[model samples]
Target: MWSTEDVARDAARRQGRGLSTAQVAEKVAEAARREQETRRQLDAPTETEIGPFATDPEHLAQLWAAKHTEWRRIAALLKTSGEQAYDPDRDAQGVTWAQERHARRQGALDRHAAWMRERQDARDELRTQIWLPADTSRRLRAIAARAGLQPEQVITQLADHVRMDEDGAVVVAPFTPHRVEGS
Candidate 1:
C-alpha cells in the first residue's frame, strides 16, 4: 500500500539529492500518471474476437481438476525433499477443520437441491392450474390481477402452500378458514 509520494521521497533520500516539496509532489504525480496508464493498458481487452468455448463449463472443470492434481503432486514432492516441513502431529488439527468445511458444503448442496425440486414442482403445478379445462387463460390472468401478482407468482405461492405426499397424490383443501356467514 505504499503511495507514489512515499516512493518518490524514498528515492530522493537514497540519491542524496535534495528536492523542494513542489518537485517531490510533481515527481509523485508523474509516477502516478504513468502507473495509471500502465494499468489501463494491462486491463484493455484484446481486439481479436474470442470463441464461445473459451469459458465452456467442461473445459473449466478439466482445468480445475488438473490444477488440484498438480497441487497435490507438488505438496508430495515438498514432503519428500527433506526440507523443514510442518509436523504431522501439529497439522492433525486440519482434520477437524476439513470435516467442518465439508459438512458446511454438504448442507449448502442439500439446500440448493431442495430449492430446485421445489421450484420444479411449483412450475408443474402452475402449468396444471392455469390450464384447467373449466377456466380460460383470461380467468387465470384476472385472478393474478386480483392477487396483485403475475399469474406465475400466484401459482408458485399456491404450490408452495400445498404439496403432494410420497404416494404420488395430492389432497386438496382450503388453505384458510372462511369468514362466518353473518360476520
Candidate 2:
C-alpha cells in the first residue's frame, strides 16, 4: 500500500532532480489534496443521474444486470485481443491473472445479488416494535451479553415466559440465565 508521500517521492525521483525534505513533504501534501478533491468529485451525484432506486429491488436488479453485461462484453473483447497475439511463454502468467480477475468480478456480482435477496426477504418478514426506558434497554443489553445472545433474542425468549394475571397485570416467570464459560 503506497502512501501519497511514497507516490510523490517516486514521481520526483523519476524527474532526475533531488528534492529537499521540505520540498518532498510539500509535494506529498499537494498530491494528497488533489487526490481528495478528485474523490469528492467522483462521489458527488451528477445532474443527469437517474432514480436513486435504493428501495426499488426490480430497478436495482436491472441496473446491476446491465452493468454485469457490460463487464462481460469488455472481458470477452480483452480475451479475444489477447488470443490474437498469442505467446505461450509470456502469456502463461497473463492467462492466470485474467482468470483470477474474471473470478473476482463474478464473485462481486454474485455477492451483490445475494445481498439484494436478503434485503427483499427482510422486507417480507413480520416485525414488532416497542419502546423501552433507556435504563431498561441498557439492562436488557447487559443480560443479553451475559447470556451470549443478541438483545432481540433475549426479548423473544422472554416473551415465552410472560403471562397475564386475573387483575390484568403482566407477570413474567423467573429467567434462567445461561452461564458463559469465562463468566
Candidate 3:
C-alpha cells in the first residue's frame, strides 16, 4: 500500500523529471478545482432567474427550511445505512474508502431525486449566459463601479431596450423601452 503522495512522486519519476512536492500538491488541488467546476456547470440549468421579485421572503425561508429538513433526513438515513459505522483495518478505524464512497454518491443522488420531486413546484429563478470580450468586460466593470451598480444590474437595465422572447431570441426590430419584469 502507498500513500497518495507516494503515488504522485512515482508518477513524477516516470515523467523523466521530478516535480517539486509543492508542484505535485498544486497539481492535485487544480485537478480537484476543475472537477468541482465541471460538476457545477453540468448540473446548472441553462436558463435561470434571480429573484426577490414576486415571492415573500418569509415564504422563501419556509421553503428553504423544508429543503433543509429533507437534506437532514436524507443524511441521517445515509449515515445509518452506510458501511457498518466502523472499520477494523489500519487500527485507527473510521469510514472505509473506495467502494463506500461510490455507495455514498449513489445514495446522495437518490436522495436528491426524491427531494427534487418534493420541491418541484416550489422552484423559482431563471438564468441566462452572457459573453463579452476581455477588454469590453473590463470597461463594463469600470462603468458599473462608477454607477454604483453590479455588472449584472447594468446589463439588466440595458436589456429593457432589447426585445427578447422567452426562448431568449432577440427580435430584429427597432428598440423599445419597457421594464423587463423579473421572472
The digit string of per-residue lDDT tens for model 2 on 77-166 reads: 335554432232333433454456557668988999999999999998758998999999999999999888878878877876889999
- List residue ranges in candidate 2 displaced over 4 A: 1-126, 177-183
Model 1 C-alpha lDDT versus the unseen true structure: 0.48
**Residue range 11-115, candidate 1, lDDT tens digits:** 333331333334434544554554555445446745655587454333334433433333333234335543343232233333344455557668989999999
True lDDT of residue 43, candidate 2: 62
Per-residue lDDT of 6 in model 1: 32
Tell me the deviation in Å of residue 13 in model 1.
Answer: 48
User: Model 3, 12-77: lDDT tens per residue?
Assistant: 234312333344344445545544554454466345454667444344344334333333332343
Q: Rank the candidate models, highest lDDT first.
A: 2, 3, 1
Best by lDDT: 2
- 41 Cα displacement, candidate 1 (Å): 12
